[model samples]
Target chain A: MSRLSIRSFSSSPIASKVGYSTVQPVHHLIPIKKQTLGKRFPELNIPKDDIRSPQYKPKDVYQDRVNEYYQNVLKSDLLLHYYEHDSEAVTGNKARSWGEFSPYAVYRRDRKPKGLSRATRDIKPVTPRNIPELTGISINLYNKAALEESWINISARLQLAQITNVKPKVVYNKSNVLPWKVRQGKECGCKVELEGRDMTRFLSTLVELVLPRIRTFKGIKDSSGDKSGNITFGLSPEEIKFFPEIENFQELFPNLFGFHLTFKTNAGTDERARTLLTSLGLPFYKEVKNVQ
Target chain B: MWKSGLRKYSAAASSTASAGNSTSISSTLLLTRNPVITADVSKFEAQYYKYQNELWKRLMWTFPSWFYYRKGTISEQAFRELNPGPVFNNPNIEFPRGRPVVVHQRDRRFKQELKLPKTYKEVSQEKKEGGETAAEEEGAKEDNLSRQIVPNSRITKADESKDLASLERQLSRTLYLIIQENSKWTLPTFKEEQVAQGDDTKDSSVTPLHTLAEQGLYKIGGNSINYFNVSNTPCHVHKSESTREYFIKSHILSGRFVPQSESIKFLWLTKEELGEYLEKDYYKEIEHLLSDI
Candidate 1:
């Protein structure tokens, strides 16, 4: 509740004429409340990780059929167990006390092959149904000038549609902010979501014709993931000309604007997303070393 | 046959004598019995004879007397008045001198009845009644087909999984050629002319293979000669909603791209860029061919 200071409205001449009954206090509810364990028993509240079994295996098992025979037959441990000390060696080898058993046997056993983690070992093969694919690409334009002048919003919408080859939806200001000059429900920006063939086509233009041609464009930084398989980047106002649609009718748009491009993918993890994206032909700057 | 014919001649003479004295009912009966005199006498004779030759035949077959004997042509207005009505009058109901005062409502059901069949019983009786063997056979055929389909589906699944595994290995070092159309970047594909089957091989220029080679060179440009060795068959195949596309792989024997078309630009994007740029299915088709190399 606000401090019960002198009511500013009561002092006004209009308030005296209208009477106190005309003015009513508006009730505002708080958005969030602190959590307490409600009426449930404390012991019954189990964590999700606790419920999951320790052993992990994907439903779609990726068994190496081609190397199945070799895998079953040839295990490095079976062929040779290089122990560190004399006591650690096998009975026959230890009795012989031969130095050539393994000159490099400094440790108990050599490490497994590079990508042989438990997670990778138990991976399920990807099917056509579960294949990681591009969902859609969204172009978002935040027209800061629109807040000051309303007419700019209309031109921004037209600009986005012309460049993206689809009609854009007008984004409105959600809240009233006097300082920023934004009014509630006023059109402030425009966005377009491209899917299916259009998404692919737009992506093709950005990756090939537009992004690479930009002088300052040095591939997407490794840190640019949304942590949810979606990668987003921005282009400058000048880069808009690289789009063939925009390039063809350069006279139409005298004042070009830049926009944010978001690539949505079905890969569950950022790593899978990165892999899926890498295959599509986008370059990642920092991940180059890691990928190699 | 001769005796009966003579008896009939004597009877006709007596019937003439009787008709001369007083017109008798016997003569009227004879008129009805004679095939030429009555309209349905031939139909009655057919019931007994049942054979073509046995049935009495008219010596001269002509149109009805009313047609030629009428005052005008058959369809003329006056001809309708001249045409004869039924020979016997109905004793039960007398024809009114003028239009009858009583008006009866015409039954609409009669017209509707004409559209329906007279009897529906015979139709169902004619339907062939067979055994369940056909149904059993059909079920067995379906079972066989389903059985055949099961293994095919499994084989395809296995093949896809195997393909995925091999794709991962191949992805590390694949070189992609992206061709630009309008503003969009897509995989570089040579559009081959769809040739009709079994055409003459004399014109090597028109063959699909040759056409692909020519277009491939044009799209690839003359600059890739140093490092790239373009292959004969495509490593990845994609089909858009409109056209069939294939992604061909070549070893990067050594050089960079030299743009060929003014509007149709070209770019050498990494696998990740290709994945992001191309259509989902298009990228997926060549996804296996991509790797970190």
Candidate 2:
């Protein structure tokens, strides 16, 4: 907010060169709203995470067992497991840049990376510093029935909040489809992004209490993941009932909602992310394809 | 990085270097029993957590009783009976300290406390009802989910008696398996059988470091140990003039490590405890590999 001092950039050579008129470019990378840029609003100036700020919330309320296990045990084990002697970082195929001083190449985007349409992340050898750890978990509940009855999404949101202990944000439809009777901006679902203690708590509950109770759960499919360290798997409404929060209160939650859980990690690849998750007690099974 | 330096002196290269005087290659099992319970925190940490937990509870929203316990239901009546409503703020009464700001049956200033009706009657309650036989019958139904959850004590019988050989001794620490051979306590190290030199047909007999460790473990421990090998690769290597010991990292998942031979005495101990038993210089070389927890 007002903590950042405003400086005149008109005098600088770079600013002068890019200047179209008398007005100078803003020096700040992030544009501050005019209403929040004054000393009168002292509360706005304080960071949201600071104790003095109104938005401050205590996170580490107790010793997180799941996170502690990862730190003390899984970390070193993973580092040693992934260790490779004389292994070098395998750089990803990056987008090719046009030759310098080419008139046609000016203001043009670079060509797509080799083989892959998009650039993939470089595979670095695992070390003590860069050992993969669960960063966050994003649970998204898509209520297709809400497309017709918007109020139905309320139950989904409430269901998510009850299980996660965090209020979910309502997700809206982006496009209209006449065939499906879907309209743009319709409240179709809800999502909650969990981190820190809440994330670990959810992870422990899922692994220890819920997953084992599920009858048909072989394991998470080996193929599930975004290839970029985020592994996503969906729980059926029947499977979701295994959660202790909903199990004892089946009468209260008459209509249960299923959700997709995406485990976000800094492992950089799906394979490593899967390994990290497996080490944390969530099992994975190889998906067998039927041969005709 | 040290692994790379040791890679040059691998068993394959070293065996070929000095055909006559080949250095003995051995596999050292770095078997560990991971902490079953959360690590014990310091006084400062415990206090900080308690303070934060209290703050969190104070800031928490009132539990939605209406949602869980619908009005007019038998369960709702039981819940109401268990958790009586807080003191109401009457405008007619004069306030001395402060008027209680009651909202949703909770005082806004204080942390809300609620109790649900117990699924099973307590043993003392049953005794008051003159049902001595019922209390004895309830003791047999320990696995009943309706019974109140009582967590097991963190300190096991092994800990109380200071039995280092038991896996349950230290529930909150990483325990390593060390054996006593020739009256010297050290990590379980197994040496490869020296094959005859210049035997071209028996080249395939050379076992991988991890395989050697597994074979050695079953040989001494009677194959009862159900362990998970972290990887095929060796985690660490200890170099000596006469022998090269490759550390094969593994975790004992279940089962007991029974000593097949009476001469070999083994103990599962924590990092600090191992330092006392192991040779000072030998422990110092591999201290970084052990987990502090």
Candidate 3:
């Protein structure tokens, strides 16, 4: 109560008049809460990750076999597989600097990377500490039907949540297009980012159960990467039904949504990422377009 | 870098000089059975995990029974009967201790313990009630989906009986296949057939190291064994005065390794056990190649 009284007295206009100053006192744009004002309420200021914090949540609940397999078995194998006699880091096209004597060059950014708008990452040789591994998976669903009837997106969100254990965030349209009927601020679909145990569980389910069950499903395309370590592939609505969650609860979901899955890795290069994904049980196939 | 270059040059020169003697190239099989179960955690680790799991359960959101079981349905009633509501925070009650903070049929202070209604009849319950005969119970149609999910024991019969040769022995550690040939325990190595000097036939061509290892594996341990070779390229090389043994890593996916010959003896052993059984110097040299887990 004493602390609260002192806080209230400090904020009053008369408190400013007691102290002489050259500048006028400015009020905070946002009103400060009493709980966050004083050092006495240290519990409120504690980080959420700390055990004493009210919002603290436990993370490592069980052993992850996929991560263990990578650590114990795959790490050394990858190092050996990628080993070359006296290999060096293959550097990418870096940005060039403007002349230092130029007056316009002062406080200016360097020119864009050669032949590309964005700079690419260097492809480093695989070592014991830098073995490529799957970091996370991002699943994005774009529902065209939701552009007209927004209620249809709820089912898509629920479907994604059912398949992946994590709750998905709703994606919204960015620009307005009159012909396509796309408008800004409209809820389109959903996306879910999976990491750690969730990522391994989703990967195993996709490889062992889902991918093999699809009749027309070939492997992911050989040319399906962003040149960096991220690889993306899409599943059809018909093939999405192969998921066990949707197969069992078919009646609950009427319209299945086809979504794109992007596998993110820290392998530095797409080729290494592909090899890592193959070792983790995902296959890649080359597409033969023409045979004359 | 210069040192490595020098070593490589020296090795190349030595190999050329020994060309007259013809160094024998052998493929060593490093076939292993991956751990079937998660690795065993230490006592402290187990305790920490348990504590974290308990905290997770305590802080978890209340289970939405209203969504799964309708408000006025038979299944809802059964669920309610199985899981009784926590003590309500009544304004009329005179309390000596702290007041109960109840929300969504749960006490916020304690972890919610829910007992779900069982879908299938348990075998123990049937035996206790003495309603069905043992033969009748066995003959009943078993629906896989409706059946109770009881995990198999991690410790198999082979482990309990201390069967070293059984593939089912270790559930949580990698098991390597080591064979005893001529009273010496070593990794199964297959040597290349010496080619005739004047024979220039396609049949007498040099076989790849991985192929040699595969054929040798099948020749000794029957074709029923299902395995996956990690890569065609050799992972490690051990060079001696006469022979160069290249290690080919592989994993036994399924099936068993059955020794075809009477004299050949094999045992599935972990890394530490391999050290005890194998030659001291050989084990020390290949220690980094073996997985501790």
Candidate 4:
């Protein structure tokens, strides 16, 4: 058990706390000892050759159907593969319904086309169960200077996000999600382990969850730990029951969800990232804001 | 219908360079994660291999540990020790056993090594310390170029001239023109206007599916289906009333993205919304199951 040192490949040091992404078998399996993300991507700052810029040429109008055919028939590799089955009752239930929200493909396409592999047909779609839920939380700053000092906040969240089983997806959007209609209850559809299930439970759970966890735990600086300070963990609805607020909203949100808690400190960077993290009630970090 | 078309394009691409190497260039021919090809691939096998390798090359960005991260089972005791917390309400939910979370792995390293470029800091430091630009760097280490590559999203691009509304309009119009040319949709405004007084019957000519496809907003009989993929399998059901109707129904019914067929029949769905559905496949069972009662 050697300490994981996360340093950028650059001659300049890239230090961050260590963490792992846990997925069910057939996906993310961590080794006994893990290397830091920075080490894995030493070339983070470098530019590469053959980075083809997409030439987005508008195809012929009549080609729309052909394009549509490609989109539907040719599924993207990013699609979470799932095995779908149902009793006709479930099928009938499904039949009775129309449009769905998440873009999970019914039939998972192969990573590559036929011919390249010995048996392309042998490849099966991963069952819905196989897909891991990831939770993302973004912290945007009202102040430009705060946002610019990224490592201060990014490192903190990264450490918390990496505690163990929990997987974190981070983004820097002025707003947390796509500029579309927000969902009703759940935080995210990410296939990652979460802290609390909802807003209320999150507060209590954080004290419980992170308190026991120790790693020479310090806030932004080594001297100032979260002894009297606050740190945020973006939460989902299913995790809310663990919150102290659950008693009030129990009936409303039976399914506990995770909440986004912003760590507040009088520290230079705390106030900014905290304000941003706390406002994120649900676990959302994919959306990058369109600010000037 | 698309098979011949794709094969044709692949063949054309095959002709440009040595068929051996051409496949390496346009390698990311659209595909799913399984990386399995299903169609006839005898003629373009080289191209297919290039596509496969290319896809693996790209995925390295998102999940670096895809290759070489061995998954193992953590015993219940080990699991508890690692996650000394309360049990989840869902009993079936079991966490992974062996691997602690490590973000980067061999594959990601491979990619990093593939796309390295000198940073301004590096250039500046070198200049201060006595050095030259990329040409000098290039002459010394060509392979090092791919070492520390960062994706575009990480780099802030200053260009966003297209506003949301404008982008939306452009997208919608793009969809409109596409549907018109591909489908048997006939526009009457150009054919004959009332003011032209040419022919009332001719001006009225329209594809039957136009009404359904044109509107683009339909609530699944019970769900909100974002998109619909028209299957032209028994021949790409392009143009013709029944095909259009079938295409609409295909979006509503059968297959992985099959939505609640009930509400989708006449659900209030819009064209732009449908474009999203077309762009991405919706996972029905898992996501929909979490819906609020």
**Among these predicted structures, which one has the highest DockQ?**
2
Per-residue C-alpha lDDT of model 1 across residues A165-203, encoded as one tens digit per residue? 566887899998898898998888889998754566676
Flag regions of model 4 displaced more than 4 Å. Answer: A1-292, B1-205, B208-252, B255-293
**Candidate models: Cα lDDT each:** 0.46, 0.81, 0.79, 0.28
Return whichever of 1 and 3 wins on DockQ: 3
Tell me the lDDT of model 4 at A273: 30
By lDDT: ranked, best first: 2, 3, 1, 4
TM-score of chain A by itself in each prediction: 0.54, 0.83, 0.82, 0.19
Residues A51-151 of candidate 3: C-alpha lDDT, one tens digit per residue:
76644667777677788888887887788667656767777788879978999999899999978898777777777778888999999999999999998
Model 2, residue B42: C-alpha shift (Å): 1.7
Give the candidate order by descending TM-score.
Answer: 2, 3, 1, 4
**lDDT per residue, candidate 4, A1-292, as tens digits?**
4423322122111232232223221111122232353666543323332223121111121112222322333222112112122211111111121225446644444333233332211222223222212122223222122243543433333233323223444334334333443223312222223322321233334545542243432322222223223444443334334434343435433233233444443222322233223222212223335777
User: Candidate 2 chain A: minimum summed lDDT over ten consecutive residues — where?
Assistant: A15-24
TM-scores of the models, in the order given = 0.31, 0.87, 0.81, 0.19
Q: Report the C-alpha displacement of residue B195, candidate 1, in angstroms.
A: 54
- Identify the leading candidate in terms of TM-score: 2
Index of the highest-lDDT prediction: 2
Docking model 4 quality class: incorrect
